[model samples]
Target: MSNSGHPKDHGRRRGLMLVLSSPSGAGKTTLSKMLLDEFSDVKLSVSATTREPRPNEVNGKDYFFKTQDEFRAMIDRREFLEWAHVFDKYYGTPKADTEARLEDGQDVLFDVDWQGADALHDQMPNDVVSVFILPPSIAALEERLKNRPGSSPDMVARRMEDAKREIMHWRRYDYVIVNDSLDVAYQRLKRILLVERLKRLRQLDLEDLVRGLLGEA
Candidate 1:
């Protein structure tokens, strides 16, 4: 390890795909933002979508907005690592840019739902480190949805229903975080990323380093 105590500081390594999934009102998005702010090497994977951008959403920063025809063309070209039809819209991860980033040793973070997470793992199982975030309780989740800016009663009800289905897939993830306390959950998320980054298989120069240590170099 180098001065930073990170194995990546000492050797070259392929970066990981960190998949974070949760229901709409859960804290996965918040945790993802915290991780990105903390780790300079990690970048968010901007997805391509057919949905209309919400307020304050940017074109490339939030999502690559595409028409239905454009999205279908991309699908035909096999340009997506994974794609899913969600909530009457198409959403996908672009393959080329994400692969390039991984090869350059930059971790990509995915803030997706369970369907997207499943699709990503199916396509790139070895590279994916999946985490599922859960609300502490259903009541808490309802409160969160209701407290959202401009949240209506119908929208909250619909999201609550979706949350129940999403919570059932928690067991599929490598790690599960109950985001009762934002600080505690963020720390756990950071620890997971750090430990995963230090795994032996991710250290590309380990073989040479070990040989030198044993006087074989």
Candidate 2:
């Protein structure tokens, strides 16, 4: 927990988990990166994966890439908040690290898919705020996919097909933003985070503040 207005109350304030989910090429990754860069208090949750790192990915920066056996062992021990196999690769968010950050009052950001978002919400409904990002149109989404490196015609078509199913989960999210413009989408995401952070239930010491205001504490 975190105390927004007072100090010396180390155990009083807690943090929040903000999740942003979108299909490939919808600009969720770009928006998350920009939000992290702008918000000093926000920390990105680096997920653990069984997939090998991409060309520019760093060991601890992009993800904690692990072998299949290692990932499976964690699963056996129930160490993940949520785990899923996507495109034949395994991915999971470590439960301990996320809980620790929240207890310490540092907001955590998750760029995950719908399944993972649902799992987190089930585990921590009050602390989780999910947002779904949509591309302006399927045609625009296809164009973005085509422009990405190593993307083939077949891959683009498959992504477009998958995107339709993913967008159907948009209603499951607390907020939805259409990525027509990166700048506008980023601002909307920022606003969402800012407002969520201010929710009264999230601030553990709010009772004291309220009573003080009324001279009744």
Candidate 3:
């Protein structure tokens, strides 16, 4: 409920899962890369996937590659914060991995869909700051998808349909930025992160900070 300023944040702050969800061509990936490159303490949410690594994909850095049986065992153990089966492969965020980062005061960026965001919010409502990026219009999103090198006409059509579906979940997010201009959108997203980091509840050292303030009085 502490919304305005960092009055009690002279000490360590707990980190959050800053989720950025968008449809195929809506620029979430680009924003994620920019944030990771510019912010020293922010990292990507490297998911555990059952799929084999492609060329140049390194284990642990690119993904935690696991066999199907191993992944199922993890599911039974409840090691994932959120997980889903997509395109015949299981991908999930390990609870230990992301929670470790959060405890160490490093934000983890999640580039997931709306369903994944919902699952994350349900698990850790206070520690999740969700953002949804939107294309200006479906026509614009379709054009962007069509221009992408690997997208076929059918692929673009299917992505457009999916975009419409994804856009419907905008109201569920804490913030919504239209990816009309990359620079503007990034500025807004960056500001949101800066503000959320200072929320009083996230400042884990607030008790010590308050005691120090009283001592000064």
Local accuracy of candidate 1 as per-residue lDDT tens digits, 1-217: 1124444356798899999999998887888878887788899998999999999999988899999999999999999989989789998899887899899998999988888888889888888999999899999999999999999999999999999999989999999999999999998998898888888878889999999999999
User: Which numbered prediction scores highest in TM-score against the true structure?
Assistant: 3
Tens-place lDDT digits, model 3, residues 1-217: 2223323346798998999999999999999888877777788998999998999999999999999999999999999989999999999999999999999998999998999999999988999999999998877888889899988988888888888888888999999999999999998998899999999998887888678899952
TM-score of each: 0.86, 0.83, 0.92
C-alpha RMSD (angstroms) for model 1: 3.4
Ranking by TM-score: 3, 1, 2
Please report, as a residue range, the 10-residue window in candidate 3 with the lowest summed lDDT.
1-10
Residue ranges of candidate 1 with Cα displaced over 4 Å:
1-8, 50-61, 65-70, 86-89, 211-217
List the candidate numbers ranked by lDDT, top first. Answer: 3, 1, 2
| Candidate 2 per-residue C-alpha lDDT over 30-122 given as tens digits, one digit per residue, 9 for 90 to 100 | 998898777766899979999989999997778989999999999999999999988989999888888989888888999888988999999
List per-prediction Cα lDDT, in the order shown: 0.89, 0.88, 0.90
The list of candidate 3 runs beyond 4 A from truth reads 1-9, 215-217
Give Cα distance to truth, residue 73, candidate 3, Å: 1.1
Better of 1 and 2 by TM-score: 1
